[model samples]
Target chain A: MCLAVPGKIISIDATDPLMRTGKVNFGGIVKEINLAYVPEAEVGNYVIVHVGFAISIVDEDEANRVFEYLREMDELAELEDETSS
Target chain B: MARQITIEPVTRAEGHGKVTIFLDDDGYVRDAQFHVTQIRGFEKFCEGRPFYEMPSLMARICGICPVSHLVASAKACDQLMAVQIPETAEYLRRVMNLAQLIQSHALSFFHLASPDFLLGLDSDPATRNIFGLMQSHPNIARDGIMLRKFGQQIIELLGGKRIHPGWIVPGGVSEPLSVDKRDTILAMLPEAMAAIQRTLDWFKRTFDQYPEEIRTFANFPSLFMGLTNDKGELVHYEGRLRFVDATGKIVADQIEAEDYQKYIGEAVEPYSFLKFPYYKPMGYPEGIYRVGPLARLNLINFVGTPLADAEWAEFRELGRGAVLSSFHYHCARLIEILNGIERIEHILNKSDILDKNVRAYADPNRLEGVGISEAPRGTLIHHYRINEDGIITYANLIIATGHNNLAMNRGVLQVAKHFVKGDQLQEGMLNRVEAVIRAYDPCLSCSTHAVGQMPLHVELVNRDGRVVDELTR
Candidate 1:
C-alpha cells in the first residue's frame, strides 16, 4: 500500500485560485482539491487527499506513526528470528 | 550487506518507471520497490480553463491512450451541461470507444507485452523485441500493425484526427457520423475480425508452455471492477459499476455511475505520484481492486458479441475463474477487439446512429456534478463543482490507473518475490515486472500530464550514501 505523505501546506486563497477553489502546495507540487468537503480547513493544516479530494485531516504525528509502522514491518527477518528461534 | 539490482525505465510499458530488488548475501529475497518518477499535474493545470477545452487538452496527456482521456473528459463536461444527448450521438461515442479498445489492446499485446510470450522470457535482451519476433514470426508483426491501425482510423473518421481527437464535446459530438465514413469503417470490420481470430489462434497454440506464468506472478485474488449493462452485460459506453470477487461472485453490483463517491476512496503513498483507490467500506490494501481488460473479463459472464462470449467460456474453463494470468491480458485484448468489431457493426447498422440531430442543449447550471464512464482500462470518474456561470470550481479525477495502483504495486512485489532468485536476477524476472504493467496498459499521460523534457533519476539507495545498483533502460 502507498502511504500518504506529509507535506506542509504553503498557502490557500479564497480568490479565483487554480480551480476556483484554493490551491495548496505539498512542498514541490501544488495540488488542487475540492473545497466542498473541507470548507473550514485553513492553509497551514495538512490534509490527506486521494483523487484530488481531501478525505481526512493529517498531522505530522499521524504521518510519523504511519512511517513507524512501515519501519517495524520492514525488519521482517528480525521478527521471524525472534518468533522462531 | 545485500546486493541490489535496479532496472530503470522498466521497459515495454507505457510510462517511465524503475524497479529495485534487494538480495541478501545468501541470495534470498529481501525487498522490492517499483518507483514511478514523473508527475504530470493535469488536474492542477486544468483549473480555471473552460470546461469544453478539457477534451482536447486532456487528450494530449498520452499519445497512446488519448481516446480514453478524450471520452472521459467529454463525458464529464456533458454531465455538467445536463443535456440529453441524441441517440445517434450516443452510438457515435460508442463507436469511438470500441475503436479505442481495439487499437489500445493491439498496442498492449503486439508492441508491449508480446516479447515475453513470443520469445521465451529468458530470451536475450538485445534480440527480445518486435524485430526479434519479426525474425521468426513476421506475420504476427504485420498483423499487429494493421489491427492497431484499423482502431486508429475509426477515431480519425469520427473525431477528425486519430491521436487526441477534439470532436467529442460537452453537449454531444462536434459532428455527426457521416454515411461515407461509416461505410468505410463497416468495410474494415471483416478484416479486423479476421486479424483478431488469427492472433487468438496463435496464442492458443503456444499458451500451454507457460503454465507457471499462467498461474502466478502478478496473478492473484482481488476485487474486479468494470462497467456492465444494467442487466450485467459487458458495456463500454454507458453502464453501472460492478464489483466481483476472484471467484466471480458479486461483491457490490449495480453501482450507479453518477453516485460514485458513496463507495470509492483514494489514498496516496510517499514513494510515487500515483494514488491508490479502493472500495471505501473495505479499507486500504484489503479493499484494493483490479481494473482494465483482465478485470472486465473477470467481472462479466458474457461479452456482448457472440464470438467473444464463446471465447469467454473457453477462458473460464481453464480454472482461472475470472482469468488471473497477467499473460492472458493479451487474450482479453483479442476478445475485446472482436467485441469492438461486433459493437461497431451493431452501432453503425442502427439508422438513428447517423441521425442529423447529434447535438443537444443544456444550461450548464449545475454547481456540482460527476461523470463516470468505462474507459478501455477501467472505471473513470470525473467529479467537478462548477461556479454559477459554468466555470469549473473544483475537479477530482479518479483515473483508471489510479484505481489500479495498489494492485500494480502488489503485482510488482509478488512478481519480484516469485521470480527474482537470491544469486542472480534473470531476464525473466524483469519481464515479469513489465508483464504486470502491461496488464494494465496504463497511459501515464492520462494519469498525470507528460513531463517528457525532464530526465528522471532511478537508482537503488541504501540507508548509507552509496548507490547499490542501477541500469537505465
Candidate 2:
C-alpha cells in the first residue's frame, strides 16, 4: 500500500461547493488535491492524501509529529553523507 | 433471492476491489461484476496546481508503479513547457521507467500471480499466498524477493528512493546518474535476468496444467492497444499509440499522444468507478479494447531485446492473431520484466547516459499538453490544460487499469459462469474469480480511489449456505 503523508493545504478552490479542491504543500512540492471528502478542510489545515483525494484531515499535533520525523530523516541522511565523504 | 457471492479486497494486487457473483435460480451464474469500491480523483485534485509538480504529485497515484506516473506526468509537464528534455535525461528517464516496470512486474508475477501458478488454485485460501509460496518453494521465493530488490535498488540508485522518487521532474530528471550507481545496477542485472528466466521457464511448463483457465478466463476476442517504436517494435516508455484488432490487423495507427481523446472515448458504468475506454469509431461495448502487457505484446512486432524476444515468440504462438486469453497476460508480464532488465542494462552501457545535462528549464509555453507512456500495467496518458500563469486549469488521466475495465468486467463474468457453482461457494471458486481480475492486475487505487467506505450492507446466508438477501445496516 502507498503511504499517504499529511501535507498542509495552502489554498482551496471553492468554485464548486460539492467538489472542493485544494493546493497542498508536502514540504516544498505543492499539489492541488481534491478536498471533496473533507469539506471541513480549509487553508492551513493538514490532510492525508491517497491518490488525489484527501481521505482525512490530520490534527496539527499529529501532523507536526510526522514533520518532525521527516526532519530527523533529512538530518540522518546528511549525517550519513558527511560520514561517507 | 439468488445466491450472491462477494470477494472483498481482491488479494495480492496493489489496491482494493470486490467481485460480486449473482447466481440464477437454477444455480447457474447470472452476472458478475468487478466493482472498484474506492475512488480518489487524481485529476480533480490536480487542478489549480503548477504543471511542474505533476510528476511527483501523480507518482502518488500508485506506489506499485509510481515511476510510470512520474515519467508520463513529467512528459506532460515537458509538453506544457514546449521544450525538449536533454537526450541524457530522456535516456535516464527510460532507464528509470524500465526499472519501474521490472520492479512492478516482479510484484505482479512473484508476489501476486505466482501463488496461483505455483500453488494450485484449489489450494487452501490461507495457504494460497506468497507466504505459502515461501513455505513450499523457498528458493523461488528468495529469487523473487531478490529480483524485486534488484529492481527497487536500481530505482533507489537513480531516483534517490525506491517508492515515490521525486527525481523525475518536468524538464527532466532532478539529477544526473552517478557512474558508481550505473556500475552497481549493471552488476546486478545478470542475477536478476537469471532469476526471471528461471521463473519464465517454470511458468511456461505450468501453463499446460491450466487448460481450463487458459480457455475460459477472459479468453475472447477484444481489440489490443499499446505504444510502439518508430518501426512498430515494442517500446514502453514512449511511442505512438497503435491498436490491433483480434485478427492482428492494424485498426488504428501512429496516433499521437496529444490526440488520444479524439480516438479514445470513456464510458461510465454504475457498478465500477473505472471507466470503460473504447476506440471511438467502434462505439461503446463494441469498441472495447484491452491494454497492458498482453495487449502490448499482441500489438507489437517484437519486444526489441534478445531474452524477451525469445519469450515473445513463444507468447505469440499462444494464439493465431492476438493472444485472447488474459492468462497469457501473466506470460506477457514476465516477458516484460525480462525485457525491462535487458533494456536497462543496455542503457547503462551507453556513453551519453552519464551526460550531466539532464533538465531543460522553461516556463509554460502551451495552454494544452498531453503526455503518454507505457506503465507496467499498460498504456498511460496524462493530459493537462494550463492557464496563462502555468497553473493547471483542467487535467485528465487515462490509467492503464481503467483502459482494461471492459475486458476485466468480461473476464469476471466469464470466470463466474465457468467457476462459481450453486449457492455453496468454495473458497477456490472465489479465488479463481478474483484471479481472473488479477490477470489484468487492476490497481483500483490508481484507477478510481474515489470514495472510502460505502454503507455496510449485510448479506444473509441461508441454511442451505446461500446468500439470499442483503440487509442494510
Candidate 3:
C-alpha cells in the first residue's frame, strides 16, 4: 500500500532539521519530500523516497565506479586479444 | 444449455478475484477457472528506474506482504552491487522478514480464514466475517489481534513504519537496531509465543471437525518448493532453493537464486492474470508444484526451534510423504508463527545484532540480478537487469500467489464438483468453494498487483452468457 519513488533533489529547505524538505523530480513529476532521514543529501542528489520521506541518498560515485570497472575490463580484454593475435 | 457460475470478487482474501464454474445442461459441474480480474504492470513500468530504488518501489505491491517484496527486491539490488552486506545487517533483515511472516500468517489464519472455522462454513452470511469471529470467539479474536500487533510493532520499530518500511535498503538496512528496540522486541516475545501456542492447541483440537474439507480442499499430490538452510532446516530470509516431489523426495537441491530460470519456468493462461510457475523438467500443467507454508513444512527436516520443531514433528506425521491437503496450510501458518517468534528472539540475542555496520556502499557490478526469499504465502522471486547507468532495463516478479495459480484453479474445480448441485446456488456450497481458495490464503493483490476490496459477488449464467441468478455479500 505504501509507495516509494526515486527522484533528484531540485531544492532543499534545511532551515529546520526536523522538517527538512526538498523538491524532488520523479521523472517528469515533481513533489516535495521529507529529507529528515538523509541530512547529508544535497541538491542534485538522487534519493530513494518512501511515503514522502527520503530514506536513502543514492551513491552516485559508487554507482559510477561499477561502470568504470566494466569499461576498464572491456579495454583489458581488447588489449589481450590484440597481443594474442 | 450449459451454464457458468461466476464468483466475482472472492471474499476474505487480498485483491480482486473471480471464479467461473461451467456446468453441463443437467447441472453437473464440468470445469472451473479462477480468474484474477485486476492487473498492474509493476515489472513493465519499473523499466528505466535506478536499481537502488527497487526495494522500496516494489514494496508498493501489497500491504500485507510488503516486507517480502522489500527483502526480495533488496536482494536483487544487492546482486547488482556485488557486495556482501554486514553480518549484523543480515541478522536484522532476517528478524524483519520473520516478523512480516508472523503478522501476514496471522491475518490469513485468524482474521480472514477463521470465520469458517469458528462460525461453521454453513453459518449465516450476514455475520460470517471477522466481526462475527470477534463476537463469537472473543479470546481467539483478541489473540489474533495481539499476535498481529506484536509482529507489526517489530516491523515499525525496525523499518519506521508497518506497511512500507523503507529501512531495508539494497546493500543492507539503512539503520542499525538500537538496544532499546532490541529489548522491546524481546519483551513482546513471551506473550506472542503464548498466543500462538494457544491458537495452535485450539486448531489441533478443532482440526478433525472437517474431515470432508480435509479430503477435498485441494488435497492431492503435487511437487513442493521452498528455501532451506544448509542443514536443510526451515528458513524464511535466505537459503538455497529446494524442490521435493509429492512423496517428499528431493528433486532439486542447493539451487541458487541466480539459477531459478534454469529450473523454473513461467506459463501464462488467458483465463487468469496471474502467471503459473512450474518445474522446467516436468513442463506446464504437469510441472505443477505448490509453495508456501505447506511446502516449507513438507520440505524441511526440522524447523530448528524448540517449540516449532515439536510441532513440525507432529505435522509431518499428518502425511506419509508431504501433507497433501491444503487445509493444513492454516496449521502450517500457526507453526510458522511460533517458529518466527523463536527465531526472532534467537537473532535478537546475537552479539553483533546492534552493530552499526548495517549497510555496504557499492556501485552496480553486474548487469543482471535475481533475488529469492520465502514470503508469507510462498517463495517470492524478483529479477532485474540494469544498464551501466544502473537504470533498470527489465524486471520480473513471481509472487507467491502466482506460483499457486494452477493449483488454485484445480482446487476451485475440486470444491465446486464436490459441493455444487442443481441450478440453485447454496450459500454453504459457494462458501466451500471460496474456502478452498482461502486455504492457500491466496494474496490476489500481491498476485495481480491490483488494488480492491474483499466483499464477494457471484453470478450464475447460462451458456448464452446471461445472468440467471446472483448472490452478493
Candidate 4:
C-alpha cells in the first residue's frame, strides 16, 4: 500500500492531460505527484496520494486542521522550520 | 518455418518487455535475448531537487514496491544529514518493508506466475489467467487475494494508503504507529501465516509435476547477492551486502553501502535501457550474478524466525549448493512471505513502538550518501550527491531488476535453447520462455521508469531475417 498521506499542492504542471503532475509539499519534503486522477485539484489544494497519483482531494480547512493537530502535538518541528510563517 | 522467433509485448508484467529467439537452419533454437525496450531518465530528471525530497520523489519510480525506494532514499537522506533516527522509527520501517515483501511476493506468485504452474504451462492462453485460476481453484485464488490484502492492510494501517504513502520520510517515518494499528496486525498474524502455509504445502506437493522446469529453468552457477544482518541472517531493509558464489561459498561479506562502487559497476547495453550491474572484479558479462528472492534464499544461512526457518532448512536441502533453478524463486517467495509475517509480528510485540520521538532532523552534513536495501525483487541501491544548497546534483538508482538483467538474459537463452523449436511453435513451449522471465519477477516499470507501454511480441524469423511466426500473450 503506497497511496497514503495528504500533501498541499504547491504548483501544477497541466501541460499534458495524461501526464498532469504537480509539486506537493508534505510538511517540508516536496515531491512531483500525478494529478490526473484529481483533475479539479489546484495549487494550495490538499490531495491524498497513492503511488504517484493523487487519488482524492481534501478541503483546505481539513488539511490545515490536521496540521493544527500536529502542531498541538509538538510533532510539527520539521514544518515549523521549513514552512513559511 | 522461420529460423528465428520473437515474442514481443509479453503479458503479465508491470510494464514493457520482449523476447527474441534465434533459430538455426534446422529450426532449432540457437540464441535468445530479453529486451527491456523502455527508458527512464530518473537520474537526469531528479537533479537540482532538494535532498530531502529524495524519498518521496523516488517513491514514484515503482508503484509495486514504493516503500523500498522510500526507506532506502530516507536512509540516504539521513546519511546526508548525519542523523540517528529514533529506534521506533527503524522498527516501524522494518515492519513496513516486510509488509511490502508479503504483498509483492503474493502478487508475483499468485497473480503473475501461478497460472503457468497450476494450470500447466501448456494451458490455453485465454484460460491461463487469474480468472482461470479462480474458475479451477477458487480457494487458492481467494487465499492469494486475502494474503495480498492482508499485506495491504498492514501498509495502510502503518502508513495510510497502499501505493506510495509519504509517511516514510527523511531521517525517519512521519509518525509513530498507534496501539490500534499494532494490535490489528498482530491479530491477523495467524490467518496470514495459514494462507501462506497452505500455498507452500501445495507447491511442495506439486513439485513433482514440473521436474523439467525445475532442471532447465535458469539452472546454472553464477553468484548470489543479498543483504544479511551482522549475524548473517535474512535481512531486507538494512544490512551489509553479501556475495556468495555458485557453490554457496561467501565471495565477499559485509560490503558497505558507501563502498558499493568498488565492488559493483554498472554496464550499459544498447538493447536495454536498464543497466547491467556486474561484479567489478569479474568484469562485464562474465561477472553476471543473480539477486532477488532466489539469491537472497541462497545467500542466507538462517531466516531467524520460527516458521520460515523450518522452510529455509527444506529449501536448502533441495540443492546441495545454490538452488540454481530459478523455478525455486516461487518457493523462496512463499518462504519470504512467511518470514515477513513472523518478522512483522516480532516488531509488533516489541516495547516502546508507539514512542512519539520517531524522526531525527538535521541539515545536510555530507555531499554523498548511498542507501542500500533488499527490495522485494532483490537488492536496491540509491546513490545521490547533493551540493551545499542541499539540492541534488547527481542521482543514480540501481534497481533490483537491473541487477538481475544479466542473469535474466542468460536464463531466457538457456530456456529458449532447450524448449523452443521453430517448426513446433507449441503454446506450452512458448509459454515456458515467458515463464523463465516471470520466475525472476522482473519489474520493468520499476527498472525502466521510462515512458510508454511495451507489448511483448515474440517473433520467429528465417535465415534472411524474414519473420514467419510471432506470439503475443
lDDT of each: 0.66, 0.75, 0.78, 0.77
Looking at every candidate separately, what fraction of the true A–B Cα contacts under 8 Å does it contain?
0.00, 0.06, 0.02, 0.00
How high is each candidate's TM-score? Answer: 0.78, 0.79, 0.81, 0.81
Kindly indicate the candidate among 1 and 3 with the higher TM-score.
Answer: 3
* Model 3: residues with Cα > 4 Å off, grouped in runs: A1-85, B1-14, B445-473
Candidate 1 chain B, poorest ten consecutive residues by summed lDDT? B446-455
Candidate 3: C-alpha lDDT = 0.78
Tell me the deviation in Å of residue B163 in model 3: 3.4
> Which tens-of-lDDT digit does each residue in B23-55 have in candidate 3?
777777777788775444446657878999888
Of 2 and 4, the candidate ahead on DockQ is 2
The residue pairs found clashing in candidate 2 are A32-B45, B38-B450, B39-B448, B39-B449, B39-B450, B39-B451, B40-B449, B40-B450, B292-B378
Give me the runs in candidate 2 sitting further than 4 Å from their true place: A1-85, B1-15, B23-27, B445-473
lDDT-better candidate, 1 vs 2 = 2
Candidate 4 achieves a global lDDT of 0.77
Q: Which ten residues in a row have the lowest lDDT in candidate 3 chain B?
A: B446-455
Best of the candidates, lDDT? 3
Worst 10 residues of 4 chain A by lDDT: A69-78
**Model 4 per-residue lDDT at B203:** 88
Q: Model 1 clash pairs?
A: B27-B422, B40-B449
Each model's backbone clash number:
2, 9, 0, 31
Ranking by DockQ: 2, 4, 3, 1
lDDT of 4 by residue, B36-121 (tens): 85434446656878998778666653444778898888888988998889999999999988888888788778766887888887
Error of 2 at B245 (Å): 1.2
Clash pairs of candidate 3? none
CAPRI class assigned to model 4: incorrect
